[model samples]
Target: MAGQACLFCEIVKGERSAHVVMDAPDAVAFLDARPLFKGHTLLVPRDHYETLTDLPGEFLGPFFEHAQRLAGAMESVLGAAGSFVAMNNRVSQSVPHLHVHVVPRNRKDGLRGFFWPRQKYESDEEAADYAARLSGGLT
Candidate 1:
């Protein structure tokens, strides 16, 4: 990733605060500080891997297992019609560490192509509420 100062690594290590939605031994899911939607979540591996190819073969299954749960939570918990799940290996990856974006989706959500209009929670309390709901759905 971005050496020892990786942002996602900081979140994984609890050095930075994030509205965490799912915490497991291998991965951590959290609400996007700048969300694409209210319930948008980012799922990252606890370990720092710069890109998808950097991830160990053994880690692939466990990493995506958490993603599956998050995608489901977008619908099961947030009442979204469906979900949009994606990852960028290097080109469009904002953070150096690998992560997948799990965004709630509806038929007329107005998300066209790769251009996403970002959104924000009304407040931290609202963000936390979303985190709590998605977090519970994973269990």
Candidate 2:
């Protein structure tokens, strides 16, 4: 099924632009514009799937695999202590496309609060390095 003007759908169709980190036949991973951390990335299936239930087993398998790879790349690039992967559906979903968030976390990043807070970047050079290093691993 085709998605209804969702950002992810646009991205999949090349109608939108993203700093794509990793992409396979079934799934695509890219940097999030509004990042929760230094190396926050998003993973989604190329085919339209509004939620987890809508994703076929075949597509779901690779989606997770690519997501895991992305997480590993983030760890190496950002020196993250760990990574967090999450997805929201229906009530919690801000976007209607089935997508997973891969957030890089460090112990001293001040994200331990109940609410996940975003910290300011000192410069774009830092953000660029984070994206470049992760993207390099994708190739």
> What are the per-residue Cα lDDT tens digits for candidate 2 across 45-79?
98878899998877767678888888887677667
Candidate 1 residue lDDT tens string, 1-139: 2335888999999999999998899999999999888999999988888888989999999899899989999999999999999999889888988999999999989899988899989999999999999999984
lDDT of 1: 0.91
Query: Which regions in candidate 2 have their CA more than 4 angstroms from the true location?
Result: 1-3, 119-128
Question: CA lDDT of 136 in candidate 2?
Answer: 86
Query: What C-alpha lDDT do the candidate models reach, one value each?
Result: 0.91, 0.79
Evaluate model 1: give its TM-score: 0.96
For model 2, how big is the CA root-mean-square deviation? 2.4
The window of 10 residues in a row where model 2 has the poorest summed lDDT is: 119-128
Clashing residue pairs in candidate 1 (N, C-alpha, C atoms within 3 angstroms): none
Model 1 shows how many backbone clashes? 0
